[model samples]
Target: MSGHDLPRLGSLAWEPALDRPDLLAAPVLAALTAWAEQDERVRTQVAVAPIDPDHADTATLNAVHGLPTEASANCVVVAGRRGDDERVAAVVVRATTRADVNTRVRRLLDVRKASFLAHERAVAESGMEHGGITPLGVPAGWRVLADARVAEPGTLALIGSGVRRSKLLLPGDLLAAAPGVEVVEDLATAIDA
Candidate 1:
């Protein structure tokens, strides 16, 4: 995922005010950048400034070419359980592809149940501020899983930067390379072609 080899998704027309370097100066950004530096497979190809109002779902699709065919996909991390202790895990699926958490992840994690963590707890425990939650800065003990559809060719996702004001465009394969990530099909529903 070196900046050199990254194929242009499309004309990157947007001009971000890189002047405000603070946009990516947070701890979460540091962690994500560190991971990207360590692995060429799971690196951040580009960091895009999220719209002030946050049009992430649509903006992410538009930012990349040959993507966003009818429906969009994203990777989300949910805090769950591991041996009676709370933990976090990621699930990648289309905006149209819902993760059947109650059924799929529960069985996968061997937990009696699974649910989206409370917003407050998610922000605090993940060490990432709210709206900026990305699997990048997730706690070490947590597990990650991506729906196989995430690996589909040309798939793009809107991943958080540990801050809501910004996001990064990540190829499905690169996302799969996130630390401790477990790629699986357990969390997705099919979309008609």
Candidate 2:
């Protein structure tokens, strides 16, 4: 089946992954592209879309593109410090749920406190746009913590392609198995609509 044949992605205007020069320019995205090329599971499953950089945020993107909230996922960079050492993780959760940073994340990192990484720090460290820090190509040694929901088979997760101008759509299980990624339960708490 063609990439567009993937469920939940047929509605979006997806361009061939190799054709997106804008996405390949970003270091993190470039890394992801290389990784996908090497991994058959990801090479056949991923799709990319060029979007308005301004609407990259989940709420606006969903409203404008008519995508379901559940199909979109958010990648948040979280940091915790233990004395001289710092631990960083990219937390992936569905847009409908918020990462449990204070409790679950802190416990996982074994740090006294856990909080979202500062915007500048996140961008500088990941070498990606602020609104597009995906877990796929974060700095080596950083943990990628994906919520269990993101790993459910057949779930199409809309996530950042490491740039605000584009997004990636792929099977949740594929993302969960990305290099150094860990699928954790209760990583996020559902928000009441």
Clash count, one per candidate = 2, 0
Indicate the worst ten consecutive residues by lDDT in candidate 1: 11-20
TM-score of each: 0.73, 0.92
Task: Write candidate 2's Cα lDDT for 51-165 as tens digits.
Answer: 8899999989998889989989999999999999999999999999999999999999999999999999998888888898888778887899999998888788898988888
RMSD of 1: 4.3
Q: Tens digit of lDDT per residue, candidate 1, span 44-163?
A: 254455445344444454545434532345546666666767756766566667777888877877777788877787677777666566666577766777777765555555455666
- Which numbered prediction scores highest in lDDT against the true structure? 2
Which ranges of candidate 1 are over 4 A from the true structure?
1-21, 25-27, 41-44, 54-72, 81-83, 190-193
Runs of candidate 2 with Cα error greater than 4 angstroms are 1-11
What is the TM-score (0 to 1) of candidate 2?
0.92
Model 1 pairs in collision: 132-162, 132-163
lDDT of each: 0.59, 0.83
